[model samples]
Target: MNFLIEENRNLAPYCSMKAGGNAKYLVQPKSVSELCEAVAYFRSRDEKYIVVGNCSNLLFPDSGYDGAVIITCGIRGISYENGVITAHCGDSLSSLARVACENSRAGLEFCYGIPGTVGGGVYMNAGAYGGELSQYFIRGSFIDKNGEIVVIENNDMDFGYRHSRLNYEELILLSAEFSSVEGDRDAVRARMEELMAKRKASQPLEYPSCGSAFKRPAGHYAGALIEQCGLKGTSVGGAQVSVKHAGFVINTGNATATDVTELLSLVSDTVFNETGVRLEPEIRIIK
Candidate 1:
């Protein structure tokens, strides 16, 4: 496969939190073909491997991974034709949103500030500010566990709040298509900018975090619950709950995965004790 390969790579620089250890082997596939080839190669060798993009909502263990890490960030592309978008799995959701705005498509403006890739967004049904990827999803293509390509329509995606069929299916996404409405370009851009501004003002953007630490529970916001519990600015080692946004567990400096994990547990336990609600972590922890 024509892909970049590295040995003993530090994973901290890849993830948003910047607090992980290292990977024994890291492979960067530049295209869907390359990705599939690499996957097949790893499978044939019976090597444990994990595919990732952006690493925005993931936490890697300090002890590090002993397997191969395949990064699809190089497999990015976005195209729009007649109000429809076809995006590669590794394409940045934020960049895709900008492309939509440039094409005068309105529906994807909500994705403008999400710090994730199209594959991850689709897998998690990523959403914010009342809009979700499922809302515009039309169809997607992925490689299944058997190394065969499969395509699924929106109806087959089984999308829900922070959930999707990808959770149960052993599939590696390659690309996806989305439907959009024709709209005023200026209005779309304005809405995108407005949402971004709101995020900057309310979120702890200055610090290293995996965005929201916990999922929104029922009708209550995680941030509100955390703040109400007086957990803001709470710290365990170098990890702290952000004062600006109680929902985020931020890395102040030199935080370890253990520190973040411990802090998350503390915050969850404290919140549950006070509110009688158990908070679920939104970040995926890779041990």
Candidate 2:
């Protein structure tokens, strides 16, 4: 087939954290059709496979993955029409937000600075600063385990606080449509820039990190709790709790997955000991 495939590919370069080992096999699909074909190929062989885009919120183990890693970042495409954006799964969330602003479409300005892809954002119901992906979701399509295309509406997505029904199923996202409201272009851009500035000031944007390490606890914020426990700037090898934002664990330099995993456990245990609340990681770790 006319598809790109690599052997023993270093996965660190593919992830934002840049701390993972290699993937035995990596597939880069440039379109929805190619993604489907790649899935079918791996499935027919009864081999393990995963659909990934951006890898911004993932923490891969140092041992590396033994199966096929199908990367859809190459499948990028997007268009805006009639107050709606139809975008491929691989399209960057930032790009989508920019397009919306350019079209004078509001509501997606919150996603303007999120470092993830459309598929990843939809899968996790990504949100920031009082805005969530589910709010604008209309419908989408995915390839089910049976190799059939399944169309899902917003209701069927089952979006909830950084989660979606897609998380529970063995399906690959293809594309999605999001609805937005008409607003002043200047206002949208200004809001986006404001949010970005806030993020830079409060977050450890200079370091490589998996964004927020812990999900927000019901009654307390993760960063606040970490700071309360005096865990800011804590480090396990090259992995360190961000001094700027205690909620994030950043790779100072040459950090291994083991260091990150150990650091996460330490933070979780310490936080739970200091407070009754238990902090759970928001980033997905692959062993």
- Candidate 1 structure quality by residue, lDDT tens digits, 1-287: 57766899999999999999999889998989999989998899998899888999999999888889998888888999988999999999998899999988888999998999999999889999999999999999989999999999999889999999988888899999999998899999999999999999998898899999999999899999999999999999999999998989999988999999999999999999999999999998887
**How do the residues 135-251 of candidate 2 rate in per-residue lDDT, one tens digit apiece?**
999999989878999998998888999899987987778999999999999999999999999998998999999999999999889999999999999999999999999999999
Error of 1 at 59 (Å): 0.4
Taking all chains together, the TM-score of candidate 1 against the true structure is: 0.98
Q: Report, for every candidate in turn, its global Cα lDDT versus the true structure.
A: 0.92, 0.92
The CA lDDT at 26 in model 2 is 98
Q: Against the hidden reference, what TM-scores do the models get?
A: 0.98, 0.99
Q: Residue 74 error for model 2, in Å?
A: 0.9
